[model samples]
Target: MSFIGIDLGTSSLKAILVDGQQRVVADTARALTVHRPQPLWSEQEPGDWVAAALGALHDLRDAAPSAFRLCRGIGLSGQMHGAVLLDEADRPLRPCILWNDGRASAECAALEAAEPASRAITGNIAMPGFTAPKLLWVRRHEPALFRRIRKVLLPKAYLHLVLTGEAIEEMSDASGTLWLDVGSRDWSQRMLAATGLDRSQMPALVEGSQPAGRMRADLARELGFDSPPLFAGGAGDNAAGAVGLGAVAAGASFLSLGTSGVLWRTTAGFEPRADRAVHAFCHALPGLWHQMSVHLSAAASLNWWANVTGHTEAELLAALGETVTAPSPVLFTPYLSGERTPHNDPQMRGGFARLGHETGRNAMTQAVLEGVAFAFRDGKAALESAGGPIMEAVVIGGGARSGLWLSILASVLDMRLHRYPQTETGAAFGAARLARLACTGENSGEICTQPLGSPEIFNPQRDLVAAYRERYDDWQSAAEFSRALQ
Candidate 1:
């Protein structure tokens, strides 16, 4: 048997076909566009995701027809905290307000003012990126549209609705909505009410490993499937990526250096630490939870630097290799997109400090790399301060491909970092695994605990640890000054 996993990412939609042996048979990705009509605002039409997903699946079917024919289940994973509002006819009310959008900052403050217990119940500070704040923003600014809303869904759950005709959400994605009672693994009526919503407007909740619904008969037929595939309630991207890395058990953790950086640790039970800005949310699996320290920018910082320097990422990295161990006199703060973990400041901006005539291209590049690593270090410290300990971390994402960056991250965080062969297929692979569990009736622990291939380990350099610590201090001071300016 075979299963398909679809990842609805910010910039693209990726589909992976995995056989029973857990081997990837065919993978396809389709690029997506994000619209920013105003500063600090990000929006995307939900229909574009549906189109990209369909095109990706079509490509997958062409690449591996046999596996496609044998597909027994479909699983989904996607970006979290996006608000996709729908009218009574199931038509989208407007463009989805994305997770990185900072336009809801005022609404976030209003939420906190109206519901003081929000942080205690949601286990998170009110941030513009979360779903609840976006809803409140709509209620205030788009009152007519808000009144027309009858249902709400996260990005992937919206896709699920398009696929199965059911508006259902899984735990991990719902937890970010601020409407979930994370400790109880269900929707919080009080929290929903604070945002002028009710349970009826929310999608039905399910665990990520369970079946949300089966594939629509018409869609299955149109896609040339021999049988309808079971649709699993897949996870938010981070949680799904964790399952992909086999980090389901307590104390298992990984660091993701995607557009946003995240340091995630799994736990056996709910543990809320909102004081430190550590995100406490349910895992994809039932009765399991995880803590995440999120930085709004990671690989994105490198991308921006490359763009401004008029060099490709490859060119920049090649230059970085020559000055890998050189300490940069310049310090960079990577809050170009604002920050999340350790400081919930939406007005924060990033820049380089202490630049001089002697500073070369390599130093500036190194500074950017070091800046991102230091941000991860800040996240690590926040996670630890919030009572989540870490002995090691599995590092995955676009940035993990760079040996220099990984080395710098290891030294800066002072933790051993492991890299898996399947790092590139992170969240989609995990969703495929969840599909397998749903289709075969296997226990989540059994299916998700299988070892990832032998990992390459990056150990902290003994000599550079102290130097990186000093650099981190400088970075922290720079971050503080930037926030103060805001």
Candidate 2:
């Protein structure tokens, strides 16, 4: 038997086919773009996601035709907090408002004022990045569009509708909407009311491992599958990545340096530390919760720097070798797309400080690498200060491919980092694992083991750790000045 996993990322749509042995048979991706019609605003046409997923599935089917025919189940994982409003006919009302968009800053405050217990109910701060704030923004700025809304869905839920003709959302993704009573693992009527919504507008919620819906027979045949596949309730990107890394049990943890950076730790129950800007939400698994301190830019910073310098990410890293001898001469703020976690200020922008005449491309590149590491250090401190101490965490994502960046991040956070062979496809792998559990009814704990390999460990060096600490302190002061500019 085989299963499929789809990860709808900010930059692309990825699909992976895995056999019963948990081996990846074939994986493919289709590029996606984010549109910014105005500053601090980001949107995407929902139709693009469907087109990309269809195209990617066909590519995967062509790569492994036999395995594709035996597909037993499918799972989904996606970027969280994207607001996809639907009309009465189940069509998108407008372009979906994305998680990174900061245009809802005023609405975020208004939301909190409208519902004073928002932090307690949702276990999250009223940040512009969350789903409820975006809806509020639409209500005030696009009142006519708001009037036609019949249902609301996160990005993956919208995909679910296309795949199964069912309106469903899983817990981990719903937790980011600010309409869920995360402690209860269900929608909160009072929370929904604050945004001029009700439970009827929300999708049916399920745990990530459960079967939410089955594939439509007509669509299944059209896509070349001999039989319809079951659809598992998948997870938000970070939670799914954690499941992929076997970080489901309490205290198990990992850090993801994807387009965005996330410091994720699984917890035993609802633990709200919203005051620290730490995200407390449900884990992909039942009865488990997680806390994440996120930075909006991580690998994205390197991508930005690479684009500016006319070099591939690999080329830039090859120039730096495996480690740097000292702290960067310059400090970079890494807020190219604004800031989240601890600051929660969407208006804040990033830049470099203390550049010298001697600074060259190498020094600037090193600074960019160090800047993301410093931001991770900030998030680590926030999570640690809230009683979750930093020890070691498995690291995944495209950024984990950079040995030099890993070395810097290890020393900056003074924590051990582990990487497995399956780092790059962790989210999709986790989603595939969920499909397996749903199809076979296996124990998730047993099914979600570390991928087959001895992990490459990145340990902190005493000298480098001390050096990074001093530089990180200075960077903190500089970050405040940047935040003040907002």
Candidate 3:
């Protein structure tokens, strides 16, 4: 049998087809764009996600028809914290409020004020990026629309609804909404009340490795599947990426360089450090939890620079050669969309300092890479303070393709980074593994084992590490600039 995994990402929908042995048969992706209707507000039409996801699957089917026909299971993973409100007719009331949207800051504070034990309940601080706060923002500003809401689904859960005709959510993704008792791996009643929502609006919850529902018969027929595919309760993008990297055991970790930068570490138990802005959420698997230090921008910063400079990310990165001889002459802080992790200040914008006349494209590009690496250093320290240090990390995401970025990351954070094949599609691959687990009831450890081949490892260089030690200090000072940018 073959399994399919789909990851609904902010900028794309990625899918992979794998055989029973878990070897990738085919992979495809469809580009997606985020719409910014107003400053600090990011939104996407709900219909676009369904279209892109189906399109990606169609691409996979066309690429390998024989392999696609044998598909028995599917797993879903997606960007977390999106608020998708559905009307009574099961249609989206408006465009989804995206994970990176910061327009709900005031609502974040208000939610905290209303629920004093919110941190204790959700194991997370009330952030504007969370779903509950977005609802609060809508309730206050768009009361008429809020009143018509019939269901609240995360992006992946909305997809689950469309595929199965049932609204179901899994633990890992639900934890990000500030509506789950992360320690218990279930929805928290108090949190729902605080957000002016109730159980009826929430979807049924499941573990990420369990079956949520089967694909609708029509969807199955449309995709050429002989039977309705079992939909695994996949995961949030970060958790699915962890599963893909085999970062399920305690202290296992990965640093993701996607649209947002994330430092993820699995914990043996629930560990909450909301005081430090460290995210403590449930793992996709039961009896496990994870912590993350997230920055709103990582690869997105490079993408932005590439867009403004009229160069593809590949071309811009190629100009820098294999590695930098020294830290960039100028310093940059990768806080383009404000920041998270150690600094909860969403108003702390990023910028460059100490640029000289010699600062050209290569120099600026090196700084951008180093700056993101330095930001990871901040995340490293925060996670350590919350628990212990993450000695090494599997580097995954689009940025993992860049040898220079990995070199700089290793030197800046002084941790080894492992780069495996298919580094960019780790989440979708992991979702496939989850589908396998859900269908065959296999031992997770065996199913989610680390890649077999010897991975190319990026180790820290003595001289570069020393140089970065000082540069990181300089980066920190600049990162603390102000809230005035808001």
Candidate 4:
């Protein structure tokens, strides 16, 4: 039997066909647009996600009819931390506030300042991207909309409602909402009270791989399926990506470089840090916990540089090759969208310090790559301090495509970076693996035989490692200085 996996992303929806053996037979994708009406505000229509998702699946049906026929279940993986509010009739009240939207910063600040109520209930201090802060923003600014809210769903849960006629969130997605007790895997009553939202407003929580329900007969037939089993609680993209990297087990770490960069580590027990630099969330894999430190700009910063410099990534890479020989003693902070880990400051700006006349474009590029690497290393150190010893990290995502960046990461972290066996579509393929596990209770076997590629290991040059160590110390000091100024 084959399982259908749908990956709902920020800019697109991707659908893949995978057999019970966990091999992808065919894959297709469709794009969706996000609108930014004002500065620091981003929104996406929920209908666009559904439309794109359906179109992608329809394309999949045309390309792989036999695989479609053999499909036994449909699983969903999507963007996390988005706030999608629906009216009494399940109609979207407005475009969703995306995970990257920072309009809720003031609200998050106020919530964080509450001290007693904030830490006691949410198990976290509020951050701009969290759903609760977004809700509060709407309440303060658009009271009418807040009053109309009957359901609060994340992006994936919105799609699940369309497919299965149920409004619910999986443990993985719910963990991002601040309303959840991450340790207990349930809604926090204290948090709900603090947010002035009722328990009824929240979706019922379920395990990640459990059957949500069968696809509604009409919707199933429209998409060329005969009531496919819809796996309700597939997981957020991060959780799915973790599964893709096989970080489901203990002591495993996965470094993701998408539009944003993330460092994910898995542990056996509930481990919440008081610093609130990294977010601790429920893992897709059963009985596991994940802590992630996010850099708002990872590959995005590279893309920005490429666009501004009018060069392709390959061209930028060639330039870097010319510059790595003479490492510039300059620090570049990768804060294109502010920062998340170690310093959750939105006002912190990206810059190069102590630049000399010798700093060419290539040196600047090298600084950007090294800066991101250093940022990740900071997170790794914090995780080690909180959770203890994390050495091996499987590298995956668009950034993993660059050998130079991988080497930089390995050298900066002073740890081996295992290249993903399958990288680009790790999240979708991981969702397929989850479906397989849900269908048949087996952990070891081929999930996808078509390996993306083997990782090219980079041993840190002793000189570069020592240079980075000193640079990292300065970077932390600089960040602290920036925070004090703010």
TM-scores of all models? Answer: 0.98, 0.99, 0.99, 0.92
* Cand. 3 Cα-lDDT: 0.91
lDDT of 2 by residue, 92-205 (tens): 999999999999999988999999999999999989999999999999999999999999999989998999999999999999999999999999998899999999999999
Evaluate residue 205 in candidate 3 and report its C-alpha lDDT on the 0 to 100 scale.
96
Off by over 4 Å in 1: none
Model 4 segments more than 4 A misplaced: 112-117, 355-358, 441-455, 477-486
Show pairs that collide, candidate 2: none
Higher lDDT: candidate 1 or 2? 2
What is the overall TM-score of model 3 with all chains considered together?
A: 0.99
RMSD, each candidate, Å?
A: 1.2, 0.9, 1.0, 2.6
Error of 2 at 22 (Å): 0.6
- On lDDT, the candidate that comes out on top is 2
Query: Backbone clashes per model, in order?
Result: 0, 0, 0, 1
lDDT of 3 at 214: 95
For model 1, residues 407-481, the per-residue Cα lDDT tens digits are 888888889999888686789999999999888889777778634578888998877888898777878899899
Q: Which parts of model 2 are misplaced by more than 4 Å?
A: none
Model 3: weakest 10-residue lDDT segment is 477-486
The alpha-carbon lDDT assigned to residue 367 of candidate 3 equals 88
lDDT of the candidates, in the order given: 0.90, 0.92, 0.91, 0.78
